[model samples]
Target: MQIQKINLGAEPSGIGGDSARTSNGKVNTNFDAVVAEFADVRASIPSVTSDLGQSTTIAISQKLFTDTLMSQFNDIGVQGALGFGTGITNKLPTGMSQMQGTAIKGHENWGNYQYSDGSVMVYVPRFYYRWGHVNSPNYAKYGVNALDVKSIYDFVDVVAANAAGYALHRAFYDDGQIKDGFFVDKYQCSNNAGKASSIKNGIPLSSSSANAPFSGLTGAPANTLAGAIDAAKTRGSAFFATTIFIQRALSLLSMAHAQAATSSAACAWYDATGVNNFPKGNNNNALRDVNDTAVLYEGTGYLTAGKTGSAQPFAKTTHNGQYSGVADLNGNMWEVALGLTQTAGSFYVLRTSAKASALTSGATLATDAWGTAAMTASYDSLGASYGELTGVVRNFAIGSTTNQVFSTANSGLAWSASCAGIPQLGGAGGTNAYGNDRFYDNRIEHLCPIVGGNWSYGAYAGVWAVHCYFSRTNGDHHFGVRAALYSV
Candidate 1:
């Protein structure tokens, strides 16, 4: 029986096309209409660093997005994107190219190829391609998975307003090899991962080392802050100075916890195995597998010297031998502190109280001051914010036990209908208690405190440590200590 004619138009049957007669009475030669499949692969390591000054954060707030800082951040992308495009120089094994990418330019998972030791260096994987056929519906949906996140041009819109831009450190690309190359690639990030790839040039990370130490130095260009690394290498000092983007750090800290709850995947610390000279051990490319490994997000904050109790700890306690340094939440992150006067009813250990920029003005103590001084990324019951609403306090009720009635969203705390929209109201309570009737899934935080003595580290404290390590040996998971910092 003769084969059915294929519709090369709307529905392509995976196969190229069906035979067709030429209107010219000759054999048809329009076979060039179909797009040729290809693949794109690159390395995922090799980063450039950045810096800002060390001084009163208030002094240099205006310079946050200065050109110098922008230049530095942009360089991070240059190193990560281009560096991974090939591979680091003088590092690959004998058969491997000096700059390593994928073995097959077009085969699926081509760049997804892993080294024998399990050390992953490729920019992205083929799974992005595996998810969809060239013309399938899934392809159109997840097509952004194939974008190069390390590109200086990839992330711009989020930098301006979109909070998701902060979560978009991850990105992917396709260059026709495994998927599609030649700018025909697809991509995605927190929300704007591939947003500015067309026009905006990114700020690089190269300036961080020097600018990190200056006052008012922020954004991607703090010079003085970067210089503090060597001096503050012990415990979390490095974390305090390493200048991690708030969005990046918070997103990273939450990633493991989120994944653990949703997918049961224990967070794997990036060993930095065989990785060297890369800033934050990432080189800026969003392309990464981490294989079974995860990364410690870098973060920075300033602490006042007087804080010794709950007044200073962001997590409400200090960890990693650091009260004023960087943070690695995966392991040693703890509630930290600063400017802690041993006042009446004060046990000061919470870093959020001191180190945090007061959410409001007037420079009041971060402790006990709700919506006035304490600084934190806020969210309440109903996944909303207190500032969005205003009202008086009310009482709480814990419904009858039914498996503890614990909804991750609701936690064990039940609210009286009089309670504000914030499901977990916080004021003066212990552990889970926040206010007259609100509470936290695990208290250490939450505005509802039913009594005196702000108890830091009420529950869920110190689950893991975070850091930046250098990979010396290729296969071994042993991380070479480069510079590390951790908190709670």
Candidate 2:
């Protein structure tokens, strides 16, 4: 049934030219017309179903109904509304702005999303890639592949399918609903009057004192790592960036760099000579490039440098191009990742709690720390599952000549069997890998993972750089953290 507009244009002329009364026959005809129109309108209205499995007749106008439906789909409180689930919101979150034009070219489709508390987050839309063996001779010995591009989903589906069993896909799920994507802090988290922030020119926070920001919140210990986790949580729907989160970001950046390169041979994280694809950052005190001949930036120093800039042709410090990607991921402060811990020469994923006191005591992990038992069971399953044991890398020897790629023959360093084909785990050696950042680990003590070397690390600062030398209680001024948001 089609409902047309009812046009009651003018009042009927009264009988004998009087405006008050109408003839009985005319009144009856008008009443009949009105009844037919209303009946057609009623038939045109669609039925809607409720969550309780009951169908209800809606009598509101069509525009009103549409507005209500859109509200439900855009509700941020809903599990999948903002993430990978239903619909993307046109309304930007507070302090956020969408990137346009060349800034979002290729696989670099993302937006700057800021939290209410001033944490600048970059929205990393979900992308898929297949693991392919590393082609560069510098990285071939490590026996891992680079992340090859498969597909990137820019427009999310209403009923989005879960990305199950894929690398780093577990972090995209929150409470069983698959998220469209996640947000990472654009800069290393800074101290904003004791709260965790990701703003430019803010002082980066790192301290072993019990007075750290967000300390004692939710009964977490006063240590920097625990405080960082609590501080992020206090920002609402946020957590300290986890190893999975960092790994996923790196994977996306790797795929972006590969997709933009002129030759497939350049698809690896680094170029032919092992110079890393991502920016070298402020690793050197002079802010020079890998060759030490060109000055990368003219900033005062690492402590007071701006968060975002273009030191080179692209953003030398950001994960993407100039001012378009996440910043300070190479050589800034060392960002600590939660959920990654190493002890007795094996790495384990910590999923349950972020409380330092409960998880660790001095350099030793508490016996009952969560997820330890399952990770210890099988070696093959280590790199397969989320929150399971990931791969293990043999320690690199200290010194200039020894700080190159992991060579099974020369350096006696090797990646565990489970790490095969994983991107960013192993790559080329020497200058091609960006200062050939060395991976440091200690087999004896319980250690947390700190990635992205600090200033003065020179060739030792990069996206793949990993350091497992610090305990939860030990903190240095160079140690920092980044926050990530899921399902928001």
Best by TM-score: 2
Cα displacement (angstroms), candidate 2, residue 267, comes to 13
TM-score per candidate? 0.22, 0.57
How far out, in Å, is residue 126 in model 1?
Answer: 26
After the best TM-score superposition of candidate 2, give how far the Cα of residue 330 lies from its true spot, in angstroms: 0.7
Candidate 1 C-alpha error for residue 244, in Å: 12
Count of backbone collisions within predicted model 1? 153
- List, residue by residue over 232-291, the lDDT tens digit for candidate 1: 222112122211222122222222122112111111121223111011111112211111
RMSD of each: 22.6, 15.5
lDDT per residue for candidate 2 within 1-488, as digits (tens), equals 33233334355732344221233334434444544644434444443433335554544465333433333322212110111111223545444554442122222322555566667676555443333335432233323333333223311432231232123233444433555566677766655655677776555555444223334334442555434555555455435444434443453454335334533221212343333454556677555555433436545334533233334533445554334367666765677764455544555553322322122222323332323452343111223222112333355422122232221210001222112112223233333423355556553234556787776677777766667677665666566677776534
Candidate of highest lDDT:
2
List ranges where model 2 is wrong by over 4 Å. Answer: 1-110, 133-146, 152-177, 208-223, 255-259, 263-276, 288-314, 343-346, 350-394, 397-435
What is the alpha-carbon lDDT of model 2 when measured against the actual structure?
A: 0.44
What is the Å distance of residue 244 in model 2 from its true position?
Answer: 4.4
